[model samples]
Target: MSVKGIQPIVSEYHLLWEALQHYQERLEKFSSMSTDEDQQLKYDEKLQDMDGLLRSIKLAAKNDYQLDLK
Candidate 1:
């Protein structure tokens, strides 16, 4: 495909990534504000899990598609 064909796909990927990052930040803020230890722990675990997922996705994009998600 030509560069024109790839631009939209690249743009979409970046937009999706930005949205995911926004949600992650919001989750972190919510987690920090929580007063309950147990809930905070759960939120922390979720954040870690999300971090792993994001990293995995970024790596896959770079390795498989040669796309730099950053």
Candidate 2:
């Protein structure tokens, strides 16, 4: 019962999957809140950040690169 021969890219994919889940939870909570204009702007920014991260993750999966998070 040993885990071996795992590649870096696969490890990164797992990390990104966890991060995506965390962000999605945050996004859902934010969406449920009633916020002022400034707060709404902040939420928008957060959503954008999540979107960008998701896009990068997709690209990394497409290219099979673990370092693409840079």
What do the candidate models score in CA lDDT, each in turn?
Answer: 0.74, 0.65
lDDT of 1 by residue, 1-70 (tens): 2233333355666676787788889889989999999999988998998898678657655655688886
> Residue 32 of model 2: what lDDT?
58
Tell me, by TM-score, which candidate is best.
1
lDDT of 2 by residue, 6-53 (tens): 334667676866778688778767765846767767777888788776
* Number of the top lDDT candidate: 1
TM-score of each: 0.73, 0.61
Residue 15 alpha-carbon offset, candidate 1, angstroms:
3.0
Q: On a 0 to 1 TM-score scale, where does candidate 1 land against the true structure? A: 0.73
The C-alpha RMSD of each candidate to the native structure, in angstroms, is 5.9, 8.0
lDDT of 1 at 49: 85
